[model samples]
Target chain A: MSRADTAGSGERMKVVVTRNLGPDVMPLLQERKELDLVVWPEDRPCEREWFLQNVPGATGVIVMLSDKVNQELYEAAGPTLKIVSTMSVGYEHIDLQGAAQRNIRVGYTPDVLTDAVADISIMLALMAGRNVRETTELVARGDWPNTAWAPYGFVGPQLSANWVHPTRTAGFLGFGRISKATLARLVPFGFTDCVYTSNPSSTPNPAADAETARTYGLRSVRRVGLPELAAQSDVVFVLAPGGAATHHVVDAAFLRGMKSTAVLVNTARGTLVDSDALATALRERWIWGAGVDVVEGEPHVGREHPLVREPRCVVLPHIASATIETRLGMATTAAKNLLGALFGEAMPAEVQM
Target chain B: MSRADTAGSGERMKVVVTRNLGPDVMPLLQERKELDLVVWPEDRPCEREWFLQNVPGATGVIVMLSDKVNQELYEAAGPTLKIVSTMSVGYEHIDLQGAAQRNIRVGYTPDVLTDAVADISIMLALMAGRNVRETTELVARGDWPNTAWAPYGFVGPQLSANWVHPTRTAGFLGFGRISKATLARLVPFGFTDCVYTSNPSSTPNPAADAETARTYGLRSVRRVGLPELAAQSDVVFVLAPGGAATHHVVDAAFLRGMKSTAVLVNTARGTLVDSDALATALRERWIWGAGVDVVEGEPHVGREHPLVREPRCVVLPHIASATIETRLGMATTAAKNLLGALFGEAMPAEVQM
Candidate 1:
């Protein structure tokens, strides 16, 4: 999509923001004299009908992941809509083909969230492998006095290398930017090896893998099949993108292949793992434990949630990137993408179509 | 204690263990042809009366931290008692002066458990800083759907460095082996500065501080006063040894001076931190949050415990060194110490009186 002709014509255009992005990012949209901004005033999700009515004449729209950017929404905005910027990396809800046909450029916030997400990934790994949920609950439920420490009372697998375990291995279901960042955190824990599985059709890149090993001072960093990854990893991290091909990739067979002492952590999309299968694995002790920030059908998870019922399973709401600094970065980048697209400037992180 | 005359002469000296050390380590005692092993058969803490009865005429005794080794124990064991080996680093429960007067050597495990304890220090820091307790409880209570992600729903302070936070600082209350190991884990998180407080009576060593900084690739690693430590640190770690001199070192005034964004983690002895002061700090928001493995009075920390009731405060049972490998190492070390003293070999770790 080329620069819009409506930009800098002294013409006033309407801009709809799905929600107020707090003090740090709202000014980016409100300060524009050439654009009249209409923002949803509530702290909850913006209503669809109300959004459709306010977005009719909008030249650009800034939206959260919950706000769908579909064909019907595009038609409601008419040909005046030049772009849709989302405050998330995933754009599965957005109709890319329909937007491209209408010359609508899409912008997303991605790399800005890598470090925040990676930090939580490591946190979950520790919590899962170290019996944190069970241990903390023992204290909170007033059962600590009765459940006094025996020599092996609450013992779990150690995450870091010890005299008994001089070499540690970290595995990734998908080796992307966040995965690499998580692996970097493990180097100091004396992790000597790394195994990962990426898109199978893509050619292997040993040169890149060797360079990564050298950078982290690791003994080896090699790509492998899922079975090998499951068998070799002390901790398996599911960080692949969510979609049709990747759905339930960590299924019963994959879980069955894992070491009984291994830990599973998922910070990626919930659909990438089979929730019931994971629950069964934890129940049967096929795997040591799990820690998940994203669970299938989240926000609907309740007390009966199988993972929640498992004491060793540390289940958290989807908050992998909910840090103050990272959230501001995401919101600011999202706002800039919309402003830049409408003002004939380059979008900071545009999806190439 | 010198080489026992009873050993290897088939004199059949009695050896008493306060509690069973499990199959892996039980063989060390059971296989000694010159010894008669009498182990307390229960998983619970050995009864004091049973221990006193079984200890008479024993050449060596192995005990847990919970077992008290005092004048009564020495009198019960008579002049034949040569050593007491404890499967713990701290020996305050054992009367050192009394044991020295009785000419009994003391052995305790220390450095073998360092990595396990240090690993949990980082886990607690992440849990404290990242709102793990509140967020997990929200999901567990089925309040997630109503409290679904708004722009800033569950935001927290990030632990790792980013463009906005280019440098991260890690603070330690005591500069010791465990503190240094914890600092090594922080290097990959992009921590650039480290501030620590050690014994003030000792002279400062700039050359040693510089060497530490270089080793971790940090910009600075220097000893600071407690006030400066509270003011400058992003996360304060209490890793100092706990005793009368350091009791309640993290009092109200020190907590008030800390950054509102800083997190405090206590993996060392709980006596160093005042429970009521920490609860008030959380209530008043003087500091962000805290994660603690020990409490001022443990095994007595019920639901009403001040720190346990705080949403941001993550309290765990004292399981920092409760890992399969670490516990095994401690048990083996304790057993070896007793065997070495009885058989005239060097004890792996012996306390000097």
Candidate 2:
């Protein structure tokens, strides 16, 4: 029975929220008297069976990266589900084909997270370049008391360009919005040249690339093959989309081609980089260090993981977009997307199926 | 009498090097046949007695930050010492009055290190804001395999300006070259306004401040009092000159007035921040977090240190200027400074006593 029938009011549609959005954004969904909100009680990822059971008879669903929006979910929701809103930029977990076939619109947050992820990317680069992980570990382990100062001690390659190495080059694995934002940050660090690789399916726009170069005051910002990018870049940022075709793109050969002083930052996907190869390269001094926000099978990544064991590698728990403002923005966008789709209005950020 | 005279070549003047200047730059001084060089062989700090014994008849000395240039050292070197060249920006250890009385020129490496220090300041800011130290420790301790993903698990305040906070304000304890470079960096991250403190001895220039604001595209870059800076800033950066006047300037009262969401960064000298007060502030959540490169009594900072023990604080081993390019530049400058003062040439970066 509809909530309207039981309470003697107008018909209220059911909306399933996989997790409770915080006070700042959750009320947008909760305060909608026309909607009956069923939120997952816990802060953590909900159990699959619980989600499958709770999604029944829902007109809309608000999800996170941890949620799986597949055929099973669509079948459970039947014809009532109009939209599946996710509080993330990536929708790899969602079964887009099934959602499309079911005519369920999918909304994913993107632009709001660009600045936050870009900020973390630079943070990772600096942490890795300066040996923050190892040195901080030393201090935490109470080893700093005995270590005397040395002139060349703890010195790493400079990120900023100077008279010694006046030209600094930055490379992006996937030059998308987040990568471009990262490039903007690098401009102030004295990066003069840029290179990137986009999906092979996308056409190159030399005019647009030249415009971007001019906009950022860079010497060049061009498309380059993997080998050339590996060879030329002083710092290589992996900011591409993650999936089957791009898996292990930064394998042994790519690591071998990188300069000994070059730093590798992977804020995109763990699968794009070969963790074993990166570990071996760091151990062998083939590359200076690496800073990664995501791992191949993250949250499951332990001390035994190759990248985690790599002394020079800095691994964060996939927190590139965990900033308060970005998360709140994402949550609010997801809420708005859900509200829009359920009430027969234009979705704020609907994905193409 | 010199080594060259003993070898039947030419009379040589002795120069004492407190530490090895490394192979890349040491040759700049060693190649000069007119000088007899006495270098302390170890990579660590030179012993006081070793420095004293070697400085007896030296014409010049190349020192590091660890070396204390005092009355005793000056008396040991006697009238033969023409210059003291240090590979550091801070020269508080040097007795300026004694050096001036003896007519000994002082040369310090400054501008070369500005970028390196600025880079680390930003790194510390991000690290502290994002809880890098704690999260990375969780991964290091092998707890990640069991931990499930949660929405609010690692959320911290965002560093970027957003719709919620339309204009981010950055505060500088002392706005000098490093602070300005840091401000230039923050501009790309969407920081809209800046406030800083000038030396009490200098007159405030509203015209110059307005020019800086225009140059950086900031709303304002005005000089403010400590209390206002503490209250108004979203992120407060302690970049002041460290000595008696500036010591403990960011103590309890300043910390109390700060927003709980504000991040405090100290890439300047350690003494400018009161460690115990900061620890209390962090522990009590009076501030969001702190990222510090220097500490009140660093190198001696153990696990027992208040700031070191604070979970929210990111403490580095005083490596603000520890980048290869900057260090090499500083070494080259120190070497050239000695060469210049000894040979009647203009010193590249001499400090007038």
Candidate 3:
């Protein structure tokens, strides 16, 4: 009944798009004559009820990270849904087990955003390391007229290696695609050593690490424990996944172990780091500074948030992959995945379950 | 008489230091029995009257950029000033022509702070291109609570080359040591092409450009005219030397030639870019955005400044070389240069007249 109300023709397959994919990508869906598209006209998140009501009788659904694919939604769709394409690299919102049992293909954008995440990770590192938060605020406060340049004024640790620092090390909490891309970025900044802590359950391969070292032309690329990662790194990048197992991995003890001159950058999940511990560390000068793109309870992170109140802490609203090119690539990929699954073709970047 | 009043001994040479060289370097001047050092006690700039009164019988003086070396100062030094060691790379404050005419050896810190400048240059580029000013303030203003994620919310241009964009080009107004260091930093970002504009009076060495490309692993590094540079580059870095010859090199016409997606970064000097023109360009979207560490009539740039008021412009307080390591290196260089000049060894980084 909902499908009949939304779709122009009952003969054509129904495809529900949660948001406009923009002119560059919407054309891909609009050009198709064999399908009827039911796109959400609003810019904000499609209301849950609206999404559920519209998803019914849809053969394919294009969703965002906010959209969750569950058994209830599947049941509501009445076995017509062949695919659930999400325009994000993350798939935590989608229930893979339920989708697999229901014989549905799950499509997600992955490699297209690797560069964006890596670029912003390095950006946060540089911003935090160089005191961008305090310095920029000073400019905004009209303090330039009174703040004369001093020898050591607003000084922070240099991110690049010079003659004095012939070798620099970069640490990663997770050495996956995003982390490796970040490592690639550090090489040009003259990073000599690369240490990372990966999934504890995964098998360690020194040979793979050696090959990585060879590829990046680094002195060594090895998998180290979390403590070693905190202690040895000049700049630590938190790029691990979000979950119970990785919750508060960067806690008080870990923060205490970091070098006073070192900078901490997190473009990963905020659950991987404890905000209170980080605030205390910054207040005590345990670490030089921190730049984080995500928080434990983000979207609710306010001016009164502990990390936001810290002068040395730079907080961003979870926008690690917020670049036009990356978003377009994701939208295009999502559209293609939707079209592919609707016509029974292999979907690009489909989650294997 | 002023020197005798300040110094304890008549036999020793008086060395006037305008500011504390910090703990690591002050001992270098303090330990020497042959010199009588009159160091300023305050953290702020040394009063001009105090400097003039103290330099009367001094053999050497270590000055900052705020202290100018001129004819009147030379006349007041009573012909005993052997060297003017400045703890900065730029010698614009020093009257080089006057120093050369008087045969006073000028020592400056050079070949250091290159990495600092380059590091901050990239940092500014990333910050400006990525809507940092708008987004960071949004978080700081407690706006994150209501700003839910949208399909293309807060999207910006991608700095690094992605799968779709296989090549990226970087432009420079001046291609010198600092510019080269900045170029080295961009390689990891997947910049394949490099274009630059040098002194028009200088010879165009295609061979040297090719060698530079080879060294950086870039596809092509060539010298182009100003208009071509603005048109072709994805990012333009203003790193040329400051003075009349290069004043306001990035004016309205040059900015108009640039791509709408381009980002302009100026780490060299305030005079190299026109603040009003840049503000207008940003306001009209002539170019994506701009990041400048220096502004014209600096130490005076307030909230009402045109560039400061623009949301797209990211302004810094000329802290491009504001890193502890770089500052220490500069102080040490200045101290060593002073010691080297006083002892009559080859003064490190001396200005050749």
- Model 1: CA > 4 A from native: A1-8, B1-9
Instruction: Give residue A240's error in model 3 in angstroms.
Output: 1.6
Q: Rate the local accuracy (lDDT) of all candidates.
A: 0.90, 0.89, 0.90
Give Cα distance to truth, residue A10, candidate 1, Å.
2.4
> What TM-score against the true fold does each predicted structure earn?
0.98, 0.97, 0.97
Q: Write the per-residue lDDT of candidate 3 for residues B267-299, one digit (tens) a residue.
A: 988999988899999999999989999998998
Better of 1 and 3 by TM-score: 1
Error in Å for residue A139 of model 3: 0.4
What TM-score should be assigned to candidate 3? 0.97
Fraction of native contacts (fnat) of each candidate: 0.72, 0.75, 0.77
**Which digits, one per residue and each the tens of the lDDT, describe model 2 over residues B1-353?**
34344424355889999999899999999898898899999878999999998899788999988899999999999888889999999999899899999999999998999999889988888888888888898888888887776666687888878767888899999999999999998888889999888898999999999999999889898899989999999999899888999999999999999999999999989999999999999999999999998888877899999988998998888888888888899999999999888877779999976
The C-alpha RMSD of each candidate to the native structure, in angstroms, is 2.0, 2.8, 3.6
Two-chain DockQ for model 1: 0.77
Candidate 1 lDDT, tens digit per residue, A72-136?
A: 89999998898899999888878999999999999999998898898899999989888998888
- In candidate 1, the residue pairs with backbone N, CA or C atoms under 3 Å apart (3 or more residues apart, or in different chains) clash, namely none
Cα deviation of B31, candidate 3, in Å: 1.1
